[model samples]
Target: METTILTKKDVEKILTMEDTIKAVEHAFEMHGKGLTQMPPKVYLNFDKGDLRAMPAYLEGKAGVKWVNSHPENPKIGLPTVMALLIYNDPETGFPLAVMDAMHITNMRTGAAGGIAAKYLARKNSKVFGFVGCGTQAYTQFMALSMIFKIEEVKAYDINEGNAKKFIEFCESKGVDAKIRGIEEVCDCDVLTTTTPSKKPVVKEEWVSNGMHINAIGADAPGKQELDEKILLRSKIIVDDLEQALHSGEINVAISKGILEESSIHATLGEIIVGKKPGRLSDDEITIFDSTGLAIQDISTASIVYKRAAESDMGIKIKFFDF
Candidate 1:
């Protein structure tokens, strides 16, 4: 048997935001139905950043992603996050494909936010607010645009250049976008935050009712972006309960005793499967605490693998001689 090797370019050519959203939504539904296996992410700590091992299995597909976050890598002209995924055949314990997962990470993360907004935000949501206009912000916008009209984009970042660049990206997509203060950016129908701030960058007072927030950046312990009070008031939905408490946006608040485990409204999976309701009223404030999930990667990788296989897009190598 041969294993396919897909480079970043190959995977990018095969994956799309629309397909990613569908696959991620299916993964969440399967998770909600208790049909998938996803263990807690294993972590390796480093002085500069960290590495993580994420594994999951669902619907006959299995994979593990080895991903790293090195904050200082940018100083050396490298990306902050990079990843590789090994897709496997569950029955035979054979590697079926090895593919770049960095784009998978971004697309699936953005798809999660879009899925969250689909269920949690009002259908009329059009004004999208982005706090921290980095690469992740672009994918988030792409996913949101898939679901909503996205009449206007409000962007904010400490580095004005990043925000301006994001605005240019939005304009290139034929969407109207402008840079705004963080608070003003929050004054929108759907708000997405992608900052890796230990201290809260968003204020509670600024987050009004009828707003749905995607708290995207806090994927490790001690990282947070939303004010605790905002979490206290908002109907908080997380990708996973234990993971959220350990490393999501709510980790800090939960660790500080400002928030309790019982306060979380539901998992996005539960909402997807209709075990729980979403957005009961337009005046309600909702927050999706997205720590990212392994099922997302595995499911998305499955799509890329199938597309690559059909198109003969990547190189194949036989690793074992029987």
Candidate 2:
């Protein structure tokens, strides 16, 4: 069978940030509607880097996709992570397209953060603090800026030069706020961490009351950002409990005996579906444990596959010899 191949630039043209937000909201809606099937991700681990293979399909959707996450490639001038999306022909279950997935992965991740904040953050949140100044940080900023009336933003990284570069980059992109140091960002209403650091980036004292944290980097076991004490002070919410138990900030807390899996207020999905409440009071500290769900992969893939076909963006392919 002939398979279609699409490049990263092509995907970027179609999957804009606004589209990503709506797609992520819809994905959560699908989850609330009970229409998704995802197998556990298979991980290959090492000291500084690893790869994850996540396969998933959404019920009533047209395709399935396998995505991966790999960190530690920037030293070699490459994206820290990448993906491969294989759309299948429904009639015979044959492969149709093999397309690059970097754009969509970043978009989906940003979308998840925005959605989580929409549900979890206090209604008056206007300041955003990002813990790592990188591409992922850029996307998170884009999504938040688009959805929230952001009055100020602060970002920090181990490399102060990198943080300055990000500030200039955001300034060029029309971010009208000052880019400050970690301690300066500690006062923000929302805190987002995207570094690959295995140690805590923010301490409990740094976080202010009613702040919402998006724990976006701790997707692997043994990877953590904020101290477990931050979790102890916050009402933890996860995308998925089982996944977070093994891979997100909860892993660190659980291992240290600071919190129990049962202590999680609710999954973000449950909050979306109204089974549980979000942000009950102005003084509540909320933390979103983002392990990066498989359902997110399938959600975007279905969108891209259909958009490509309708807009004639991908190549047509034949089935295998029969």
Candidate 3:
């Protein structure tokens, strides 16, 4: 059997924020209409990190992603998150492509953030704030820029160096960027949090009405970035209710008996499918709780595989003969 393998660089060359946003939006629509089959993410917790097994099947594609997030990886000169993906043939049950998934994960997650902002944020949003200026921050900003004519950006991170680097990246894209305190960043029209914090860093008082938030960082239980009060007052929209309640931004709040499952406004898919409305009023606070979905990975990987094949970028190897 022949299998194609694509590296991170190969994947990046074929993927862009513009195409990814549309793919993720379509994935959301398919998932919302019950046209896909995706199991809840299964986890394996360790002393310093955790691993996740995510699998899904769409109309003509199927795949599984094995990924891990190590918070202390930067100390060892490695990324905080890494992943590998296997794209298989649904009809024959054979592997078609095996590729690095780190880039795919970042891009899809960022696309999800962008899609959320499109449905939930006001059309005229300009000022943007980013908390936790890291790898995820770059993609999040890229996705937002695709949709809005952002004028200014305020960034904040515990590591001053990370904040500086994030600001520079933004400036490279012609965005007015600077480092600011958490309180100041929170005041922007659209705020995105991408840190792996264990406690709340954004205070309730800092959140103003008519603001939209992308709670992108907290994907595991006990990890939270926003104050419970913020969730209480905001119209929370999650990618998947089961996953978000167990691992996304609202997990911590729900565990403390503060926010209820019923309080969640709707899934992003629901809004995409027209089952629920999005951004009803300019003054209503809207929050997108993203936990990253298996359908997202599979959908994005399909696009990457197709593009790589068209460009003849990946290496094809014979792994088996029958």
Clashing pairs in 2: none
Candidate 1 TM-score over all chains jointly: 0.98
Please provide the root mean square deviation of candidate 1 (C-alpha atoms, Å). Answer: 0.9
Candidate 2 Cα errors over 4 Å, as ranges: 1-3, 45-49, 62-77, 89-92, 319-322
lDDT of 3 by residue, 99-210 (tens): 9999999999999999999999999999999999988999999999999999999999999999999999999999999999989999899999999899999999999999
Q: lDDT (0-100) at residue 203 of candidate 1?
A: 91
Give the Cα lDDT of each candidate: 0.94, 0.79, 0.93
For model 1, the superposed segments whose C-alpha errors exceed 4 Å read none
> Which has the better TM-score: candidate 2, or candidate 3?
3
Please provide TM-scores, in order, for all candidate models, with all chains considered together.
Answer: 0.98, 0.91, 0.97
Model 2 Cα RMSD, 1 decimal? 2.3
Once superposed on the true structure, which residue ranges of model 3 sit more than 4 Å away at CA?
A: none
Model 1 worst lDDT run, 10 consecutive residues: 313-322
At residue 284, candidate 2 shows an lDDT of: 89
Global Cα lDDT for candidate 1: 0.94
Candidate 2 residue-wise lDDT, 56-99, digit = tens: 66655434445444455777787667777776555676676777
